[model samples]
Target: MSLRPRDMPKLRDQTLRHLDDPTSNLRAKTGDENATGLDGLASHLRVGGLYWVAPDMAALAMSSGSQLAAARWATADRPTPCGLIMFDGGIGHFDARGVQIPIEACAWGPYEGECMLWLLMSRRRLVAEMARANLRLDEEQAPPLLPVHGFTVPVTTQPAPLADLDPSVPLPVIAALAASWLLMQQPNLIDRTRERPDKSVRRSYARAGREDPEVTVVDLRRQYVPDTADPDSGRDGRHYRHRWVVSGHWRNQPHGPGQSERRQTWIESYVKGPDGAPLLSTERVNVWRR
Candidate 1:
């Protein structure tokens, strides 16, 4: 479950209190002494990769499936939570030296930076309650409060040929396909309305899968589940429809008449529906690859 809005201030204060304490020294602790193995596991996990630390209380307090299903944790959830609390506003990486490397994400929250501080504060509170015999949890096995977060985007989108595109492009496409994906986080100028499906929209074609496949016309809007998934879709179940062409060229062929008849492919956009009412538009572009 997400943190309650009413408790945000208290939670932030508790986290800051532990982090500001000079004696806390959460980052300096060794593997055996430190609850988080950030320093010890940095090399193995790769500092640039995403990592997370969560307080014990967060586990029980949050939804079992929904919380973990968040985009950040969906791909990187680990059995054990990391303990190091970073001081920056986002993810971080270390250099050759043990010096801290600060990285920031587009979004910010307590879990982003100073996560350890929050965890520590929660733990201290739990320990205090236990000492007073007020803790309802078992002494030997209290639930773990883990911070939910992770890394994404090793690089941004760049030019690529359909045939030359890395196979991994589909993964990011999958990410984009999800309704909760970050692509829709920003406001876009598109008015989507839902319409009853005329039928199970389907398209198929045969192509010589040589160096590349010929452009295949695909109605992305029809393929998408606007009713349940597409964020742009209106409540009525209708949404704007756009036509896209996944094109490719033969490996041995060039773009001209003199080109060899090889298999090459690329995408062509025939229609767009954002800036103005839906209109015919054509543009040849390669799909994004990871």
Candidate 2:
């Protein structure tokens, strides 16, 4: 869809209406390393800070990955088209040994065939359009758009640690960190550039937890779910469950590439229901390289 600076306000209002609408459903798949669906795809778009329409198709398989490529031209502004907007190959499948290996099989393309219906409105454009919408992407020197908040959950199929929760760091902050790390690791699924908050946001988050204190990182517990169970409401209700070792330590410069000293620890985590119980338990152990 072509959107100009003037049309941003209406777009934003409509986008938010759909996003917040109780009738609008959000669907997602939990596992399947090679799995692709509307939820994850939509999440990627939302995380990029764009408002989009509901996807029309579920998941499908196409034999030829080349012919499968779908492209569309979208204009970011009024005068000229911004760029050639293309579908990044929703998902593809290949038959192997009579088994449909769309996800597990190597050489298979990133999920192909799913289409996203979007009513995107640039955050900057929205602000300019609305006399009182005082938000500026340039003030932050970032993307002029703010991704939707529907898909911020971790993508890993395993649950998070429950017992021995990090006393130093708040659960919410750690969850936020996990979400950030997951997004950073999987740039394809989500871009790190858009998520990077100014130093202030990070400072606010880090100020609460043990800063420059001991650092702990847990081992990764992995789970792969192919047949992701999505909610009936069309929401990507995929659950992530995993265990990891929690470690604590100190380094002269945090995240610094150069040399530094550090400490560590081991802790277990898994998904839990609202009642506060193990959602899924496994023999997986949490350990660090050190």
Candidate 3:
């Protein structure tokens, strides 16, 4: 059945409860690697940041890897501080073979195939509960919840497509495209690494009679380098280059055996201008925090 607006909260709570239950078999089946990426993305999501996934993107994600594909879509926007995936469409469930099937088609309640699903990383309560249950083992040692939780809300109208996305494209390929774009815009932002908790965290775990867990941390940094002199303004004293920001976009990249396969890659946003030149405009990113 289609989710009711009033049932959103209960659905969220129920999903979280399932995820929190260590023994529950009803877990989101995003692959282990994708789950790690989703968990890391969740931890970085700003408290109140809402990332909207267009209907087409949501469909592509579901077709690709369900929750992880959705996560990849959410991160492609590079929502700063933190963000949650607010997908407006029908809910889906994974089959025994790990393929996504519409929830209504399963042995569940009837759904109109029109709804909004809010998916986010349960970074606090669920994580804490799992940690307590696992006794401070590393993530590899103790696989936490899929780290992604979701709920659905019924919508009266169908969602409109935000962009022309090819349903045939896999989510990972799109993710790689988004990553390429992000790398160009803010190269340092992608520097994610896994390391053991700091001394204080380790000590806290020790006090609790547990060992420290390894955590994935991303280093967020942005740098603006302006040219000292305009290359176009040489000798002739003509201002050939003005300060401008290059828009972010995706391009096809060749790969695979003999580079025979082509994949989508994102081009980063960059500033182009002579050194010390005044910028015609600047890009602003809005970040929401708890």
lDDT of each residue in 1-290, candidate 2, tens digit only: 44422332233333334334334432112233312333333343332331111111111112111111111111111111111111122122223345322211000011223212221224444355454546443323222333221111222222334223324222232232222222222222221111133455346447756232111111122231221221122245644443222222111122224535221111112222223323344477443221
lDDT of 2: 0.25
The weakest ten consecutive residues by lDDT in model 3 span 102-111
Report, for every candidate in turn, its global Cα lDDT versus the true structure.
0.26, 0.25, 0.35
TM-score of each: 0.23, 0.17, 0.30
Give the per-residue lDDT digits (tens) of candidate 3, residues 133-212: 67553443222223333322222222222233334323333333233223323333333334453566567657867544
- C-alpha RMSD of each candidate structure in angstroms: 22.1, 23.8, 15.9
Q: How many clashing pairs in candidate 2?
A: 43
Question: Candidate 1, residues 5-65: lDDT per residue as tens digits?
Answer: 2232233333333333334433322233443322222322211212221222121112111
Q: Judged by lDDT against the true structure, how good is candidate 3?
A: 0.35
Question: What order do candidates take by TM-score, descending?
Answer: 3, 1, 2
Backbone clash pairs in model 1 (N, Cα, C under 3 Å; residues 3+ apart or in different chains), count: 30
Candidate 3 to native Cα RMSD, angstroms:
15.9
